[model samples]
Target: MNDMDKTRLRINRSLILQEVRIEHVRDFLYQEGIISEEDMDRCGNVTKTPRERIACLLDLLPRRGPEAYKAFCSGLQETYPWVVEKLNSTPIPETQTKTLSSTVLPNKEMNTGETSERQRIREPYTELNHTVIKIVTRSEALNKYKDVVRALGVPQPDIDQIEYANFRDLQEQFYQCLLKWQSREGRNATVVRLIEVLREEDYNSVADKLDGYID
Candidate 1:
């Protein structure tokens, strides 16, 4: 199959997964009597709706499914307005941290009215250093990396087709794209611009490269 076909198939698979998730939620809500059978059917068929029309609606209404669901639960809010408000108000929780402590004993006591030697020596700032170095984890980094990869139309191989060298090369190219994106201020550029860069970098040939890497 051609690259575009392969890409579309991957996308369709992802969409199917999303649809199944949505359907599960829909069925649960319906069974609970939160949504009528009619509404459930309408929401379930969302994938059949034209994406272009949905995109236009998103431009005008500015909402997502979860946001809409939350707004529906809010009772006081109008559907579209609540959806927009909830979407805008969605919160990303801060990362969690762990603290460690070490204790040191004094070798000698200080002179009169002075502190002990151990008291004089400041404790190493483990918490402070942890705070300073605190950043997104590898999994979070990879998640964000994959988002840009998908947006750029970079090819993704099935698990069985992935190989070490090809994965490394793809990662290197992704980092390069990230750096370029950062340097460009990552603003005002269209999705098409990012896709163009990926194409130029031959990231579109990822499947073939994976085969070569395995060989």
Candidate 2:
């Protein structure tokens, strides 16, 4: 890849991590033979989280022969139109911050501290209550609820109780766990905090994605 192409990917890394449905992109690349089966498997399983998986794939792509960049852009079109748009547009100057602030904030200058504070204030970008419950429950359908709840620091006894209460339905078990956490945390249960805990547990993909759910 050329310097500009590499720069483009770097600039859009967070947006890709946040907005793109990675599974779809992976499949598209695999079908086109841009990435081999082994490459796909490693990206899916060897990586601990979605964030890691995306990073892994991005790392692999730049070396997958000359067609890699073109194939990646094509794949993005299927599930990440905005990413495609950004990639096609002018690259952000390398001297700029290259964070999502460029996309959310207007074209203007600000000191680093002010930018960080305002961005923090805008964080989590999503409503906490029922929306979080829905997001976790829906996203974790194929994952083990017990592990997720444990990672979230739910007490083992509470986890056991929830398992017993919803033994037949994993989604319900996860749903109940989030509800319990929300109840206990009360106003402190912000999406930002939830994301922080998830990242601490190495659920970086989930944490990275939380902000993209703004709607």
Candidate 3:
């Protein structure tokens, strides 16, 4: 096969491997009388590389036609819709950095410290959102930001913690953090609300994605 064909096949097999454990596929083949236990043991060895395991499964499929393999893949799609959706989504490239500070942050000269801090905040645009204003109260998007505060020595917030305030004030506090890391200006004097935003974040980088921030 050509290089493009080989890449596509590798991607396909990787996605397949995510949801179809070797044992399940082997058991199906064995129960179907398509492969003997000995054949499975030889071909479906767990120690083998992923490509090899997938190739072994392919060998077990009907050699006479592609229909059997197609049916098997179709069954996987029917059974695991989420896996199928993940497979269909485009894979993120390691080299790409999805930044939004240009569009999200207003155009104005920033101090050296703010610029340096902003430079550290790298992320994939798809996963990172700047919706502090629009996000619903129930949304867990800011969970990590809350965790950051807790790590900095704030106690764990009590469950169902009620801090009654006007909805507009809440939005303003959130915006202050998104625009500036602090939230003092966003609240009424009698009703100070605390909010947090992070910069210099892996919440922007692949490493940040793999290990997460605060690692």
In TM-score terms, which candidate is top? 2
Off by over 4 Å in 3: 1-11, 49-51, 59-64, 74-79, 82-215
Clashes of each: 0, 0, 2
Every model: Cα RMSD to truth:
19.5, 14.7, 19.8
Off by over 4 Å in 2: 92-215
TM-score of 1: 0.20
Between candidates 1 and 2, name the one with more favorable TM-score.
2
Worst 10 residues of 2 by lDDT: 106-115
Query: At residue 129, what lDDT does model 1 achieve?
Result: 24
Against the true structure, what is each candidate's TM-score?
0.20, 0.41, 0.28
lDDT per residue as tens, model 3, 1-215 = 11222233356666666556555456654443344455568777778986677677654443211133433444456466665465446464333223334433532333233544443352222122343233412233244333222212221221102112223354443333333322322322110012212222223332233233212
Candidate 2 global lDDT? 0.66
Report clash pairs, candidate 1.
none
Tens-digit lDDT string for candidate 1 (138-208): 22333334433333322233111332334655444445444433344434233334334334334454323
Q: How close to the true structure is residue 177 of candidate 2, measured as C-alpha lDDT? A: 81
Segments of candidate 1 deviating more than 4 angstroms: 1-47, 51-137, 143-168, 186-215
Please list the C-alpha lDDT of all candidates, in the order they appear.
Answer: 0.33, 0.66, 0.38
Better of 1 and 3 by lDDT: 3
